[model samples]
Target: MSEILLYDIPRKDPENGPWSPNTLKARLALNLKGLPFKTVWVEYPDIPSECKKIGAPPTSTEADGTPRYTLPVIYDPSTKKAIADSYAIAEYLDATYPTDRQIIPAGTEGLHAAFNKAFMDSVYFPCMFTIGPLSVSALNPPSERYFRTIRGDLLALVDSVRPEERWRKVQAAFEVVNGWYEKADNGKVLLMGDTPAWADIVVAALLVCARNLLGRESPEWKAVSEWHGGRWAKLVAALEGKVLYPGYGWTKQGGQS
Candidate 1:
């Protein structure tokens, strides 16, 4: 039995904590395929150096020049390979484990890629603002600061906003996401084909992040979880036990390979 090691940022709760959506992508892909793996938590300051030691690319430029790596890096002992980045990891899994379940169903790969890109452009960033700040609170001081500095350079920090304005933006973003859900089977079914795929996983990650960052009762939570007439909530419920592959799922202490 070959095992894989997943490099991810340590957080308060693996199931509902401040986690990387990109990292969640790889974890979802692996779990979807029922692969066995273990997670190694890396501190914020260590990501770059740790990733480079495995021949991974720099995820971000560092002030101290420490290599600046990112999450979702996986090393598979069976194949003697270390893959970095979430999408790459998903693709690698698809190719290497042909007999196993796929990342995006067969034949729809091209279409799915295009669809995912469009969704990323339109919905991902907006959702980021809604959950990014919440994630920071779950991190240790150093990691939180590191995350804020890097992300803050790109957009306004969610914590800086007044409560009224914050909720308003979160509501607006939720509307946008709900609109997409409307486009996706009118919020009736999954985003892709009959079965769940990467796109669904993307939303699932968003939903999970929102839940983790915002208490379930938070207004932001209501906006996302209840928008589109409870589309997100329903979708999450439908996918709860399905997407997670066999054995040692996220519900467990360790869902590693």
Candidate 2:
């Protein structure tokens, strides 16, 4: 058995804000694999120390020897390996525990790889493009209050993007995913088939961002909304405290504060 340690922070909502997809993906993989791990929660803007302790460097660091940030970093004490980046971490877990439910699917590595690439390109890119600018714009006297304001601005941006536009892009992306699911025939599960796979976790985590942070009233998310409303409820239920932050609530279930 490998000893695993996870690092993350609460969501902006304080109730049910979404966890970083990387964190969620790693946690879900661990759960699916029936692995036990220790978790540590850290405050934002101070994640570099934690990253450094785990042997991963922060993307940026302050001049005073304080580290800026990096997230969803995992440390495996048994192997002395630390990993950052959601896709890399997920793939590592999939390969590391090959017998533990096989989230990535066998004989279709290329397909899964492509799905991941497209997912990052479609979902994460747009999200960052929209949220990043808003976050920067909300800067104030530089306090926690300012950070909260920035978070609010990002949320508002998500809300301001009309459901129609959101849906069109999301639906197109999902259609590609749906086709993959159909071909894989993994089962009736979302993303890759009847059973949840790595692709499902990736997509689900993205949807968590959209619904929990962005708002859930988009026509673009109809299929996803329905799935989350129905079969995928278990995933949400399981993630109650682990994936959703304390105050932020999930939009689909009327759980956000």
Candidate 3:
């Protein structure tokens, strides 16, 4: 058994599971590859301190030299290494585990990086602005006040916009993702044929968060879930029980599937 530690943020229902896309992506990779890990629940405010304790480098340093930290870090006890960031962690896992199922895929790191960037910018960027409020609202209650005091203020401001128009922007982004899936899928529902790839995990992480964070009751959730003929629905179903995340298994019935 490999000793692995995953550091992630708390979902609104921490007792249930995680809701961070980056962390969720890391978890998905680990689960699909049959790697077992224990999760270290890190609150928003403790990121810097938690990261420092593990000797993980900060995301950046301020002019005055303050260390800034981020989430989705993994510590491998066997190798005695702590890696930060989703992309770096995925690559590290691929190298360490050397499984037949490769998320980054052999000899395609650069291509996958570019593809992930495209999804981040085109699909996730606009969705960020549109779903910003819902995302924060899904944070554990303790962090909600803290988040609202910082970036949440900006995200909530966007919520005041007309819901229909706000949804329009998000819809356009989903269409782009759907377009890519149409190209990628041959006779299966996954991105790279029958097998689930890292790219699938990358995209699924966001949708999973969206479904779990916003909750099915919210209009934002409805619009996102319905977009592209609920294309995400099928992918969500395929990967649902394979991993344990806040929104890993959901349905319109208002119950965990």
Top candidate (lDDT): 3
Q: In model 1, what is the error at residue 159, expressed in angstroms?
A: 5.8
Give lDDT for model 3: 0.74
Of 1 and 2, the candidate ranking higher by TM-score: 1
Candidate 2 residue 111 Cα shift, in angstroms, is 2.5
Question: Which lDDT values do the candidates have, in the order given?
Answer: 0.71, 0.58, 0.74
What alpha-carbon RMSD in Å does predicted model 1 have with respect to the real structure? 3.3
List clash counts for every candidate, in order: 6, 16, 0
Candidate 1: worst 10 consecutive residues by lDDT?
A: 248-257
Which tens-of-lDDT digit does each residue in 59-113 have in candidate 2? Answer: 5555676655566777877778888766667677777767735767787678778
Cα lDDT, model 1, residue 245: 39
Where does candidate 1 stray beyond 4 Å? Answer: 13-15, 59-68, 149-180, 183-188, 245-250, 254-257
Question: Tens digit of lDDT per residue, candidate 1, span 59-109?
Answer: 666677755578889988888888987777878888888753477778878
Top of the candidates by TM-score: 3
| Ranking, lDDT, top scorer first | 3, 1, 2
* Candidate 3 residue-wise lDDT, 57-79, digit = tens: 77766557877688889888888
Give each prediction's root-mean-square deviation over alpha carbons: 3.3, 6.9, 4.2
Candidate 3, superposed: residue stretches over 4 Å from native: 15-17, 61-65, 156-161, 217-223, 241-257
TM-score of each: 0.83, 0.64, 0.85
Local error of candidate 2 at residue 184 (angstroms): 4.4
